[model samples]
Target: MTDTKQEADFLIHPENTFLYIWQLFMVALVLFSAISLPLYAVFAKDIPVLLIIIVFLFFCDIFINLRVAVKTKNGFCWETAEILKSYRKGFFIPDMIAALPWWLPVALLFKNEEPGIITRFLFLLPLIKILKIGHYLQVFEKSLTINPTIIRLIKFIVLVGIIAHWLASGWVLIGPVKEGLPADDFSKYIRALYWCITTIATVGYGDISPDLSQNHQIIYTMFSMILGVGIYGYVIGNVASLLANIDVAKANFMRRMEEINSFIKNKKIPLEIAQKILDYYNYLWETQQGGNDSQVMNELPQSLSIEVSMYLNKTIIQKVPFFTKMNEVFIREIIMQLEPLIFLPQDYIVRRGEFGDCMFFLSAGSVDVKGSNGELYATLGEGAFFGEMSLIRGEKRNAYIMAREYCDVYRLTKESFDELRRKYPDFDQQVIETVAERDAMNKKKTEKPAAPVKKQ
Candidate 1:
């Protein structure tokens, strides 16, 4: 049952599924209108009615197509689908009709890009729909995802195809080769396709000729020249656009990396770990050069190496209050192994009755101390420390420390404290003295009764 639920969830990603259906429907409607309009024009006796239907269908098809294109541009496919679905029940038919052409949809069935015949033939509705929608959505998503190189590549391809087609047709109309061919022959189709290729490539060979009049030849020659120039200008424009996008994305990425690196450096994340993260980021960036978010995400490591490093040596140690008075070298050594930990607001950093194994030094943040008496104890801030008494007495934590805000603290584990004590027993004495002084201060405060009672 759990597996079935998971499968259902996976199959119906609301974002792409609806949009995919909508796009299919729009395409189907356009083709249907194209055929229906012509049929009505030739066979129907009510010319006025046929003309009106054709005009209405044309306008409807254009509106839907434009809506789809605009929604696609904004990356709002799911929203578009929902909006369209709300209109009428019959709206779904077009999408179904569009999906009937099985080749492209079938090609998307298998996990591999190369589709097999058996897999192609088998119409596993849910799985096939999922795969088809996922793949095309990815391509559409790439229009927003890829940085610059890919955008330039696509523009260049389109510009070339358009100009090539225009120039090829023009050249065939002007040259002598046009004398032998009918207006709508296989030869004309070949000429148009060939022109699409050659003009885009800027390759002008004088092999084909048309036997049209001199005036027509001149007009055709001029058109071909204009197309070639236009293609060149379009390519140049796209190149500039690509460069600008690359610069912006690169600048943004660099800024973010620098900020993260500064954080790690200040918090003293090990150089090795920091380097690993940087390396991984670079690897992901390279792999996702012309890819989308999913591509980049897939290439990223499951978790950062630094996170794993933190979990490895998880021994807890309490801070001795007296350690605050230690020399710079001694303090620095302790701080070196100490990692800064962060806690979210209202989160319990240290719970009452839990075995205390680590000490915390408040670096920059506030924590609420709750005592067993159900009274609110003091809130601690920077330079303040906690969990020391429990660690020294070898007892469970007596109070709960909860973050009043996002809190940052330096933590030292029991193993590290023990190692420090073994190296310098004199330092241990300083800690004991510091604890004694604090205890004496606490006792004095408790003993001293309200002197202001006389005024009242």
Candidate 2:
């Protein structure tokens, strides 16, 4: 059983380059254990060098597992006792099973007689080590946090293809040793692979058929037919599922884009307007995958949607002192009422003397605050807000705000603010105080010094 704390806690150390290097080494060792070890055993001779290489890899496997367990245990913030318990339950049993083959070779060194059935069976023990690949996959899933989709695809291929390759290669290596098995072109691996592919595809070309007389050969042929069908079904189904999931949304988005292009060409819309439309659509597609955020939010329960809204706008709302003073629940309610607005370069968001009924929070890009005569007063970027004073006081806008570039803002209507004020008396008091301070500042800016007139 996993500790409750360990299950909830995941330490993501992306800055640790050494950890990444270690993970890569683990992947290499897993591949060697799962794929290479079996291949080596197939053609292994009594060479001392081959023995040394096999033994070295076997020790490396043990060492890597130990190091990984220590790192993982530390990452989980495990105490000494907990680490010991986890090591016993998680690592010890599986590591022992994987380590079983390492001793088999050492035991065989004392044998003076010719190699027998026992020797061949000893070579087969490494197949048990392939179980470690599952553990490695779990580690990789937890440790690595970059390019997740590509990494997942690579894992899937390694998990499936390596196992299949091992089984096929093992069959080819073992088939010739059996009695009464005809050894022709069928013994060649290239020929065997061709046969396997044909069989798996259910397209037996009659070029390679098993001898029916020998029981072992018949059994082997039956196994191949069954295994081939299974492999084909599994591969085809997964590939189809992956394609269905990955491309359906993308294909629809492309079709919609093409339609927009055709419409623009036919209508001959102004270049500026067309480009703005394209930019808006591109931003929507990139950020939300061409889906409506409001529509998606409507599908969820109000409580859940509000929570999600709170999470999404947390940073922006925190930057605005107005929202920060309100309790989190009221803040969430305010966020839920906010709607997204986009502006292109040079677009006037609000002109001085225009009636103001909405405030804006800049989520992205920048805007220039200009005086009545179009003199630049100030510039505001992401996390800045404007127009709230006019909206609160039911007055005209104080300044002209123009988009310096393409901008994304969250608009909060006066209706929503009024509704909030009516619900929360304390929040209403705060808003009134804020409006007073803002009005005083504006008055100060507009007031002229009487002393200058006396000096003239």
Best by TM-score: 2
Candidate 2 lDDT tens digits, 151-228:
556666676566456656655665534356556433555555666667666788976666666677568667877977
In model 1, which range of ten residues has the least summed lDDT?
122-131
If scored against the real structure, what TM-score would every candidate get? Answer: 0.33, 0.64
lDDT values for all models: 0.55, 0.69
Candidate 2 TM-score, true structure as reference: 0.64
Best by lDDT: 2
